[model samples]
Target: MGTPQTVLHVDDDPEMLALSTATFHQFDDISLLTATTAIDALDIVSSHSVDCVVSDSLMLPDGVPLIEALRRENKDVPIVLFTAKDWTEVADVASAAAVSEYVQKAGPDDLSTVLEHVGMLVDGDRDESLAAGVSAVTEALADHADAASAASFSLDENWELVGQWVGDDELGIVVVEAIEAHAGLPAIEEPLYDYIDADALEELLRPVLEDEERPGIEVRFPYGDFELAVTSTGDIFARPEPGETLY
Candidate 1:
């Protein structure tokens, strides 16, 4: 690892900050920095070239406000909301701020999720490949405007099915189908509601895609064994969950 990825973790709790410091030590590629308040975090970000920011929702000024402030400092820096609060509590505000990812704090294992996202968001190697795949998928959709059903394309050797082009009316259906296809299930045996709230996902995505102000923003979430990346241009890409190998 040449220049290690710099990650700034913000939380008012000393225990949580210590926990994050210890957790990040497990990875050689990450250089972790801790800030107990949004002010210090912003200072750290402005001084250093931070790759990602992981913050708690219940900080002195709240996580979303910190995110907004960080956006002013650096518009494209990946910010992850690592909070113990329920997602519903901060989903709207976080979405509006364009948080790169959200991980609910549960057990110690949840820190691993935050680490995975940090790696995913900061990995420059993957960005080029993902951008290429998105471009191909967008062009394919443009070429086949008359198609009625969702079409899937392989993203890479690791991905089973990558891209789907469907209008807003069929986005949920295509997403469900993509998940089922990637998991090799005839149908989702578990309740569909158990995976993710389709309505909420659509609601979260509509404004991001429709808004001309925010360009090149993509919303990513874990869906079953796959991670779905919904782009600002109405393209969806699914691949194996981070750190998971598909057999």
Candidate 2:
């Protein structure tokens, strides 16, 4: 067996810490360490080998500050903000801080989501090839803003699609095509009826993209093993979802 992974969970609430400790006890391969303050968390990190850090957004120093400090100490250790805060509330700051994952805490079941991200991240299961493909697409979009009406890009072995966009059809084609490619079957052959409601997703995203009031807004969602992001400016990005084991 591999060396047991260590996770440091930071929260000011003693009860929450105790609950996390109890929850982690069921996993023999994981060791949980708790701290009530950012100082203590940093101290523990410096003294021990930590595979991942899970933190509450609202604490004495706040999650973003703690993340900054953690980055200074160790740039690559996975940091997950397991918070009750809405994604829109902390999205910009958290992204700037280079957070590995953001797991919203809505109820008891959310703890399992946190555990999944920690396990996947610590195991180094992220798809680097997929990330590279997404980066290349993003760069192409920036460089050729006025040149092309449509473009096609090939992903790694996992997925491929002819990415195209024009006028108000900002995200429709790319989102559907990407999801279909990821599923490895065309929509007609094996429709993801129960899995993803493509039309509904486009409707929800329409206002978000059309709203000039919120210019920098970006919408993100999980489709199969990939997390897809679409910006207001009609840019599409795809990366391996954090908690999934990408084959």
Candidate 3:
């Protein structure tokens, strides 16, 4: 058989690297390289061919942002952000950077799933084909709500929400109401609220009605069991805690 594909695992934590190495070892068709720093990992990438890079968002010693550093070396290389929480913050940056994938730094099983997807993509699997099977199902569910009508929120000068999204259902009305309530004024265009954050976005919501005439409200999402407080400046933001489930 040909040599196994190589996966570079980069993180500042030694235990995480060791655990990942042991986990991937179960698959005989894979080889792993562990790096404790972004510089060392970049060196490895320059010297050896790497199929995928599983990295942390933050590494020590100048604390190079993992995604930014990876983009400099290899833009096309598939990178997975292994993090504890703050999915919104990472997702926002990743989306802007067009990252390949992201997985929570929770369990070995989650890591395994991330590895499996990366391996398949690197091994010449079509992205659409791989995503189609699952994306279709998710899209179908998403069809339950109009994307145009999706909820939003108002933010403050610091981009913090003064309240939360409150409504009868998952429809965008909730988000609209939430923003309306916090802004104390009607949204410019649609009824739905807006999303804003400095690092991570924790809540998606509907603004409240008569926001200006009433006190700030706190909207809650039953799906993730998270809440948000919309501010008056039309910016809604949240700071995620480690180990918090975003989705």
Candidate 4:
């Protein structure tokens, strides 16, 4: 509802990509920039004034090491480290480096909490209050499982997909429950690759995934337009325009 809040997410797991995108998209003020590798994350940090930085501490070749590099430049911005291993010892270093929060990878709950903390920090709120708010949201989401569906959707406009996934309706309330989810985070990008001319598609679409086929449902590029369809098994189909081929 406010000015768009940009959150830079660094992780390699596809599922975390799905979940984090889903969670952040729920907030109208949030826009997500995803980096699959630590180097990519650094590139984003160098260019973007992100409101929050959520980095998974296990990216191979340079995992949490990237955080130190990020700190060298953007020391004031909030950074949250997500790690599977205990970080009690590293907490001191992180504190000295000015990290806003440290989250253990217990599951989605912790990641969500870290995001909330980052948001609070961006708003100039204290970490203690932010932590309390994160706990309340996590607990409320757990308690209201019956009333609200755990699944959600997110659209990566740059990636050219609108993602939607749903969770089990029959399962009981659980914190950070993994549900059968689906997302369109990268579907539209796939079609661009299948186009007759990559440059044409890039110039026409300008990285915006909009209607290509008909009115609101189809995705169209400068080189061609195609039908976008998805099945329950996660297969994506692109019915290309005349003279265009996927291969």
Candidate 5:
């Protein structure tokens, strides 16, 4: 079997802890570690080789201090601030900007969203081909998407592509349509999060997203094969490379 992805979920409330357990229990590849407090979570993470951490924002010790404590202890695990509090009020994300993801409490599929971000951050490292620069997204996605409705954002006609943001659309659904329409022969089977860390992408776009007028922003990561960008208004963008497509 491949190596398992271990997640440490921390929350003070018993019910909250129960909900998180119920949420991630179905993933066969995930080894979930539950903690009721930041202190306990820290003790667990310090010893274990954990892949990711999901913590509530307003716990007894609070997430920011916990994050600070982890960094002080040199625990570099990616942290997702899962909270019932508004994203705006979450000072850690805006002030620290180190948390991997700060997700709002609203939305029908909140747990799924957390899982999506977790998966994006966990399975994020991959080799991508950066040969293409900017090219128009072909008619492939546009054609199939007519059945769905108008996209939240527009693509450059002559554009270098990586990946497109699905927005409210199913991430899996948008990725399939994008690959079927764009790639020359072999298709993109994995979701876009597999290409780049969505939490990182979110961190980049959060500042602009905070401004109502900004609507969207572009971000690029130099280390990867393709430059990565995300629009807070909606959707995700990544430069598509031939060799980078995962089976």
Candidate 6:
């Protein structure tokens, strides 16, 4: 058989890289490369003929330098951002840089979604891959909410009424409500984003913007003693340790 297609994933998180590594085992016809930074990713592109790059937006500050660098060098490598952060902050940047796809990092299904996109890219179908990624992500978020509600807290039970998206609302406030809603307590007056270090978090979400044509993005991150995940579709998944307040 011919050699397998090579894919590169660039991220600063070792755990994410490890997770992707484990996820790729299911795809036998692919080769993988891991890089911790944009500069490192570029070096790999120089040495290897990478067919596609699955990356996190935070590989650079203002925008995705890894994608820009590849484009600057005229490598024509297909690029996608597979990330846990919302894509709005860097949406304009990624678009301007001509990224191929944007797939949310769902920890479980992210690899499969990325693989689908990469397969399309390899077939010279760019728009199809990006569109597929978006559709899949929207469905995945709704499914995740349904699964969580069926298994655990419902709106009437221990869940709080945190945030709601009416129109053109700020994401930070939405996140705050998700936390308050999860802890089974009334909404706290404090700005929740203030408590968390949002630099890295924002870096991940910088690429996602509220689009009229597409569903908004979701973000999952750890803060203090609680696990948190939020979607623009009004689902905030949270779990707190015993004897700890989630907000």
The TM-scores, one per candidate, come to 0.48, 0.48, 0.47, 0.52, 0.46, 0.48
Which of 5 and 6 is ahead in TM-score?
6
lDDT of 2 by residue, 30-121 (tens): 78899878889989999999989998874335544777777778888999998888999879768866899998977545665676677678
Residue 228, model 1, lDDT: 75
Residue 149 lDDT in candidate 6: 46
Clashes of each: 0, 0, 38, 7, 16, 10
Off by over 4 Å in 5: 58-64, 92-97, 125-247
- Per-residue lDDT over 133-155 for candidate 5, one digit per residue giving the tens place of the 0 to 100 score: 00111121222223112332354
TM-score of predicted structure 4: 0.52
Tell me how far the alpha carbon of residue 10 in candidate 5 is from the true structure, in angstroms, after superposition: 0.7
Compose the digit string of candidate 3's lDDT tens values, residues 1-247: 4567788888876535644554455455668898877788888988988888887876436755666777778878888777786788678667754677778865434655666576675675433333433333233223212221233323334333332322224434444454454445543253233433312222332222212232233333221222343332122334333355433
Model 6, span 123-191: residue lDDT tens = 544434344444544444344444434433323344333333322345565566556655545545555
Better of 2 and 5 by lDDT: 2
Best-fitting candidate, scored by lDDT: 1
* Cα lDDT tens digits for candidate 4, 21-133: 64565455568898878888888989988878888763337344667777886876778887675787567667666777888887437755766666676664344444544
Please report, in order, the local distance difference test score of every candidate based on alpha carbons.
0.64, 0.60, 0.52, 0.51, 0.53, 0.60
Distance (Å) between predicted and true CA of 208, model 1? 41
- What value of lDDT does candidate 3 attain over all alpha carbons? 0.52
For residues 15-54, could you state the per-residue lDDT of candidate 1 as single tens digits?
Answer: 4564456456545667899887888988899899998999
Error of 5 at 114 (Å): 0.3
Model 2 gets an lDDT of 0.60
- Count of backbone collisions within predicted model 5: 16
- What's the TM for model 1? 0.48
Instruction: Identify the superior model by lDDT, candidate 3 or candidate 6.
Output: 6
